[model samples]
Target: MQKTCLAFAVVALLQPALNLWASDASLAVFEKRILPILQASKPSSCTECHLSGVELKDYIFPEQDKTFAALVKADMIDLKQPEQSKLLKFIERRPEKPSLITDKVRVEEAAAFREWIVAAVKDPQLLKAKSTASVGPQVSDELIRHARKDRVLNSFAENVWSEVGRCAACHSPDKNQAQVKKFGNRVSWIKPRDMQGTMQNLLDSGIIDVDAPEKSLLLAKPLMQVEHGGGQKMLLGDRTYKQFRAFIDDYVAVVKGTYKDAKALPKLSQEVSQVSEIWLKIEGIPKSLDKQFLRADVYAKTADGWSKERVATGDRAIFGGGGLWQQHLTLTAPRDSARAKELLSAQKLAGGEYLVRISIDRNNRLAQDPNSDFTKEDVIGEVPVRTNWPSGYGAMTVVKLPAQTR
Candidate 1:
């Protein structure tokens, strides 16, 4: 009886922790790591203004959204570049307000905030809103092989040496600038645009279709023959053209679900799915693992709303197979599941697309290492789920997975 009571009490305690784990991964870490800093400071009610939520809410820039929040959590900001980062300016309050703290608590909080800002500035994902990897056309391997072979004929490199094909002479892989005297001082350029905004504009103007191959510039650009002002055509035969094409495709994918007009990316809310099977294997858990962590609950949405579905009990449900130290979690996306249903439910549109969001909280111990001091909740990396359903409804999930620390 005592063992049963103890087990029940433990399960009750873990329920909320797991729910928080499922909700927003960063929140758990954020509240744990930074809440003390904020509470300790106790900003003045004076200064002729009052801001809500410990840290002057009104002082924080309006542009810093959830993604930025992750950056903050991760502590990837540079304190010196106030103009470049709002967090630094907000915290230093150097030229703004040098006289807010009157106690040790406030002084310590201010110092911690400054240290976090410096670290946050170094995170690349926070520095730019988009990623920069280029995976070229969606063609088959055979097509890629053929394309490579065709490049051997009077290749752009050969032309450069002969003083004709100035592709390499001007746009050197080293310094991506033009070699003015050699290439007539002019090179065709496609300036990077806010990919999410550009795609939204095209969609709103009816210039593209979500599914139609003809609607996407990605599908059409390769075959375009018109001179691109500087005399380069979007031809499949040009190696230079292929490089630029690949860059644009990747930019589009990163912000695929982001809407142009929405000030920030929208949060995901629900996913529709039906239960198929369950698996559990955390039986004789090892001592090294954090046993305080419990099994995560899986859920599916329907006309009635999100319904709880059992997957596995305790840590068995956690996807944990990646060889050595690698770990992962298993979750289902309704669309990929065999038993998805489209039932009408109230929709909330934040950005352009519809999305399902997962909410969960987990624990993190802050005192383990001094280097961990630089970490903050807002800087952690996240994966976004964005979709457009045939029924005119959409869903998304802004995922916060465990950091793949190298």
Candidate 2:
């Protein structure tokens, strides 16, 4: 009986300290990181979902909301076991699975918040918000020296050069954009215009870990395994992550002096033709005799949103110094014959419907301007193709377009 009383007394002594620590977490990490994601605007009314559980007749508007938010913070923001939080799982939802919360709570927005969540749980001082005074993780000069000497890293960077534009928005030094600078080497890989310099900086600064490439900050920051001022930019099991892993693997091989060129490697023959071949034919395009007309880029609506996943790029619709002309192109789309059946199991439909957006570059400049895309308003015309039951390859799917487009 004496021992039981002693235990109760000990618990009583610790309770107040626990409450104070929780209050700090609520004020610092909850307010600074998690709240923004919780408060993110939705496409429709949020009144139904974002409301307090407590019933009160005299409750105010946002004050009540704040009270509810505090309840969530208390429940969801556990300092002892951060990863097991139901709130985290609710946000990291998959499309095929039933979502705990609506898509309004973007998982991408959780990257920075998660970093704070993990850090603040362990150390209350880490709850402080990032500021201009905030400093980045320090890298070693020796690591940079060795990474620079690796020729495989060079080749890997060469392959990524074409796709460098994808990283420009968050990784550049432009004042208008967030200046995420990489240390070592004068060249700035962050620059959208300079891929080689960007690669040099990326390697020199240690974003691509040669030792364990998958753990590299390059992949982790974008994937949100690590703290990124930018939110989650890439999904874990997607093509983009796979691509980064492949390149980083090659870079590691180079770092260890065991690098082998991918082109020189033996080919593995596999009959894995999974995508539906699309036959796109562009006809009735007028080409001015004096003007140089260029090619067209085709974008299709895939499982990922409409703008993402470029399906094809057509040949020059109308060549330079030519009259009205036509061209044939083949595009490939993910084979969804089975999944389409499941999506519309009850209600019958022909095939999967997709909206294909086509943007033509009249000048063939190929977007010389760093800031512009091939299908910019100042450059050319756009055409839309709505395909419900798209025919197979060489089926001659025709996309008709107007002469002028605003």
Candidate 3:
């Protein structure tokens, strides 16, 4: 009993000294490892999941006591079980195929925080430390989620990937071998069904200018604001240009953390559209209107007159030489509607009688002001049509341009 009491007393007496040693050790590790992470110019492992708005450094501080206190106050630190610290778990979160360099950085970051946390928790001083300093992102959780890589990719799919068909003939690797030979592999920006790969390539190839999204090569080249071998594939304010700009602008804003609230986030288009192989041809376009841009909105003939919304739409410059205009139709529906859900898998228009409203941009107004749309004054004419809306240029539903109404 005496020896047991003596041993217990010795341990009790040495406990304070042991804790002091542990505190010194944890401080040393934090200074050498965690401090370097905070001081490094490059981004931390948080970027593996977040494109912006959060970083590992945000959870850390130069002073160990303040960092520990802030983390404790924020409920980010697991005092009883340091290995389960939220900070360490965050550092460990990584994508399935992380970049080799960033993966290495992630491993080092996780290990550093793990070691520091494990040691720090054993130090009573650290557990008792009090600080008013706050840690973590200053942005709201909505903004953080908006900036996540997955969210960004979903936006890319909606605003950019869906429109790649317009550029696929010259930029898709599977189809652009000849262009690849002439312009190099860089010309094959589209990765054939790989949305994430295509987005990464766009960023890597400098096609997306995050600093000035309007000046991005993807938009500039298509608009012919910069020299492009493909000529002008899109006008300044056309549907394709609008979609591209929407994604680019939002991406830049998210990366820069400029959106302060959910209300500030870009509003998603109320309508969802997908490019379809179904073709529409307008013949007998007056030769005088040659080269003028033309738009067609197809509305299903319902018992109530028209469907009140265009079921399919197409636009192209009039082939004045052929006295015609033809292009693939884009099926569209109000977002979250039953029809929108159906169109996701089946890009087709129901067979029925329909009204085709035609508008001609005779003044090149769309080229001058992208925001301007074909108004009632621009209506060339409306034609009643009947067809199954076939799916190829060889089998397009042809309509003669109505005599000018205005």
Candidate 4:
């Protein structure tokens, strides 16, 4: 009787068909957030490193759903405590049990991935949930279908042209609008003549980091996370970054020999969409931050004048040059977790008249704080904004310096 009951519980967790996808949302979350990291992990060769000699990839998870269930059951994932997971701990570089993989996940990418894991773990069934849809075309399905080397370049040509055109703009012989010549000789991603050779060179030349694709110079140069003479061209959290990450997946696949020039890779998609989310594109600030960068002291006006909570802050220049700057922020609230609901409620109460404040930090020491009257050093702007925003919707707001009043 005891053995039978134990077997039944095991069967429930491993209930193949029903447990696999859970829903489109879960599948989407897994495909976008988890798949890239997993593909980079070399699960087929997990036994090479572990003392137990356990292979956790195809051996254990023959299918997508099984992998999802296995992650949850093995205590490798947790919704409530995402950062403190066994899987992350194993891969995190530290003095103890350092990750053996030459390639490791970036800190920002890891944090973003946790959001996806929590979403999948919390709601196995994504019903009543508004799973997200990106602003650009959804390629989650298309990627798995045509992830081969040659075909990948075609699919990538479509997606890459849309996202990384900035790279092509400066690097290509045709579009070197900036006349940036030094990199032109090393390799040209613009021409189609020697794509395999060019890409292989790009991959091997240290432009693309296999372990942390997000940290690759291909991405970092455009993102402003690292210094670029061009200044910041791409905002970190925008649709552009997401699209580029998607391309990285295929690039990694091709590099790792999982997909070749002729055959198609599996049409796998992982989603990391949040429930309540909003995007902010604040423009019209001086780009020449002679001393300090732009910072928005986010606040909500409650019944008692203003809410004490600091909703969100801004950093980095999305578009910077000629002494002018712009910033984009994606604000999200994941249901009842933390301050998500509070932000959602504040957004719901918003009127055509400004409900939030966007203050600029002109100096390194000056206070752009929303707590007190920002009449002195802080130049603030208020825009009539809407909230509880759809997946990829961004509020296009302007900032006029030296705001007239509080």
Indicate which candidate wins on TM-score: 3
Each prediction's whole-model lDDT (CA): 0.31, 0.45, 0.87, 0.48
Clashing pairs counted in every model: 48, 1, 0, 16
Q: Count residue pairs with overlapping backbones in model 4.
A: 16
Give the distance in Å from residue 389's predicted Cα in candidate 4 to where it truly belongs. Answer: 23
RMSD to the native, candidate 2? 20.9
Clashing pairs in 2: 189-198
What lDDT is obtained when candidate 3 is compared to the true structure? 0.87
- Candidate 1 global lDDT: 0.31
What candidate 2 gets wrong by more than 4 Å, as runs, is 1-159, 175-189, 259-406
Deviation from native of the Cα of residue 91 in model 2, angstroms: 58
Model 2 gets an lDDT of: 0.45
**Ranking of predictions according to lDDT:** 3, 4, 2, 1
Can you write out model 4's per-residue Cα lDDT over 1-406, one digit (the tens) per residue?
Answer: 9999999998887765554545655667667656665555544223223212122332123234565455665666664686776655544433333334523433434554456555566555432333122121123434433533456555454335433334555666566644545544543545434444445555677777877876887778776778875666655443345456666766676445454333365442321122122344554445554324444544555677555543444444424454443343323333344555454234332332234455444443322322222233555565545454333344444444443532
- Model 4 TM-score is 0.31
Model 2, TM vs. native: 0.29
| Model number with the top lDDT | 3
CA RMSD of each candidate after superposition: 31.9, 20.9, 2.1, 20.5
Candidate 2's residue-wise lDDT over 54-122, tens digit each?
Answer: 111111112222433342344655556776654455345334432345444444444544665564555
Query: What is candidate 1's TM-score against the reference?
Result: 0.17
